[model samples]
Target: MAEVRTKSGEPAKTAETKRPKRADALRNIEAIIDAATRMLAVDADASLNDIAKGAGVGRITLYGHFDSRAALLRAVADRAIAQSDRQLATLDLEGDPRAALARLLEASWELTHRYGALVIAASQALSPEQLQRVHDEPAARVRALLERGRAAGAFRDDTPIEWQVTVIQAILHGASTAVYRGEIAAEDAPGLVRDTALAALR
Candidate 1:
């Protein structure tokens, strides 16, 4: 996604600051976030009113949880990453480096495809710095795996580990774009991403 600078304006409440205290309020917050995720996944330009309606809540209720569209998008992106990280954590990443990498790529491709549109929306709504911070954990997971692979001589070490990580991310993003454009079938993406990334690493 292209880096889109966040506009300067009055500082809005952070997600933490606006977090709900009561059980019912928390439920409402969860509903709004769920609605936002589903809506934004289809349309990056999905409006706050639409999201609120989808959540079965009113605009005032949505605003009570999220101060603005950007704030809501950030929450949606954060939720997606959290869910992705949880699912990825369950994978057995403990075999030959190449095999482990393939497993990771397959799981990563699923998450990337699921969150592709939300990523685009966040790119438009969040600052570069915010986006980087949001992605840090997921990127670190890949970087650590690459470091292990390179140390084992399964992946190339001639290039920096960071560069290799970037290549992997780029390939996954490209696969997402290709599927979206009908250039490739969604069901075929995991194997394609795995083979393509492994070849590039080698």
Candidate 2:
């Protein structure tokens, strides 16, 4: 029997051998993503050159990790979404649906405010299907909470649950915009979002 060999007539590389050098590469990737997140949050049209500089990396280094601005933006949005998921998962959402929602809103608002216009950048870069999948988990959390609230008579059941979820998302997005435009104080957005959503549900 003949043994298989690589194109170079050497044994195929093992998984461990194929692994990229970790420390520096990981640090550079994280730095680039962090910088992209910060810059994109402030300006959806923030240039890639600016982001690379903010990351303390040369343009070549940024391009080495992320092929294009869209790729980097996707990475930044993914990290933000993952962090938001972990934070939301920690909340006690078992009782008093309204109170639970208020807690959720407070946390969600913090994330929304932190990420700001990054969502707009992501929407423009990612396809709608990709964006929807990214939001699925967080949206499911709200949908589940709404189902509970409606079942317990804590929230109105007149509208579709999906519509309610859309409204909640809109309110959060609008609040973020309001803060950016100086129409509403950031400190007051949580309470206002909570009140507005709860009232709308009723």
What ranges in model 2 sit over 4 Å off? 1-20
TM-scores of the models, in the order given: 0.82, 0.85
For residue 4, give model 2's deviation from the true position in Å.
Answer: 27
Candidate 1's clash total is: 0
Q: Root-mean-square deviation of each candidate, in angstroms?
A: 7.1, 5.8
Report model 1's TM-score to 2 decimal places: 0.82
Q: Ten-residue segment with the worst summed lDDT in candidate 1?
A: 1-10
lDDT, candidate 1, 65-84, per-residue tens: 78888888877887787788
User: Model 2, 34-117: lDDT tens per residue?
Assistant: 888888888888898998999999999888778877777777877887788889899999999999999999998998889757
- Candidate achieving the largest lDDT: 2
